[model samples]
Structure formats: structure tokens, C-alpha cells
Target: MRAFFKAFHYAAKGIVHSLRSERNMKFHTIALIFVTIAGLLTGLSITEWMIILILFGGMLSLEMLNTAIERVVDLVTTDHHPLAGQAKDVGSGAVLVFAIISAVIGLIIFLPKWF
Candidate 1:
């Protein structure tokens, strides 16, 4: 039980660290805040809410993972290696892809109600 609790604590710490250090993480967090406010004002249906929540989880998790990958790559080598650059680029690309998908989903859910 204590170990499980400690695991949660470590996870929270990692989240805080990433939010502080990663610019993209901060941007995603800001977007999440705006989307949450819009979700409230738009009075999302249960299904829509679920979809948005899932998007939130996916986007944030992917961003954190990308950050982690970049950090690992940096730590492993400060030298300008092609593989390292490729790893970081791929991680960033993954985050970008997910962000675009999440934005599209948000628009799909909100646009009809807004316009």
C-alpha cells in the first residue's frame, strides 16, 4: 500500500518537473485550461465530455512522453549524433500529430454549438 502511494507521488513529481521544464508541456497545459472552460460553457454532453477527457489524457501523456524521450536522448549524448536527433524529432513529431488530432476533435465537438 505504501509502495503504491509512493508510486503516485513519484508520478506527480515527474508531472510537475515536466510542466516546469518543457515549453510544449506548458503550451498543452494552457490549451487544456481553455478547453476545460469552453467545455463547461458549451455544456458538453456525456459522450462529448468523455471524448474530450480521453483527448486530454492522450495529449498530455504523449507530451510528457516526448519530453521524457528528449531528456533521455540529451542525457545519453551531448554530441550531435544523427540517431539522437532522429529520436528527439520523432518524439516531437508524435506530440505534434496527437495535438493536431486533439484539436480536430475539439473543433468537431465545439464548432456546431458555437456557430
Candidate 2:
């Protein structure tokens, strides 16, 4: 009980920190809010919501991972190592891939109704 609560508290703190400290997280969250509203306006069914939620989650999770990777790379090699730079760039590329795929999915899901 106490142990579980402690773990939950730390996890909640990390979530709050991530939401506050990460600009990409902020953008993803704002996008998700607008997408949710659009989903409602477009009259998405529950299944559609499930799919959208999955894609959104994938994008957000990948962004977080990219942030983590970049931070680690910076921490290890703050003096401009070429390999570290490549690592950071690769992580960013992963985030870009996820973001683009998610955007395409969003357009596919939402455009038909609006058009």
C-alpha cells in the first residue's frame, strides 16, 4: 500500500515534469486536445477513437523517447562529439517519422467528414 503509493507518486511527478519541461510534449498535448475536439465534431465512433488514441499515444511516446535519447547523448558528450550528434539526430528523425505518420493518419480520419 505505502510502497505502491510511493511509486505512483514518483510516476505522477515524472509525468508532471515531462509535461512542463518538454516543449514537444506541450505541442503534442495541445495537438491532442484539438484532435479530440475535432473527433467529436466529426462524430467519430468508439472504434475510430481507439485508433486515433493509439496513433496519438505512439507519437507522444516516441517523442518522449527521442527527448530521453537526446538528453542522454548531451549528458555524455557535451563537447560536440560527432557520434553523439549523430545519435541525437537519429532520435530526432524517429520523432519526425512518428509525427508525420500520425499527421497523415489524422488527415485520413478527419478529412472525409469535413470535406
Among these predicted structures, which one has the highest TM-score?
1
Per-residue lDDT tens digits for candidate 1, residues 65-91, read 998898899899999999999999999
Q: Model 2: number of clashes?
A: 0
Task: Tell me the TM-score of each prediction against the true structure.
Answer: 0.95, 0.89
Model 2 pairs in collision: none
lDDT of predicted model 1 = 0.93
Candidate 1's TM-score reads 0.95
lDDT string for model 2 (16-98, tens) is 87799999899999999999999988899898899899988788888878888887887887698889989889988998988
Off by over 4 Å in 2: 1-5
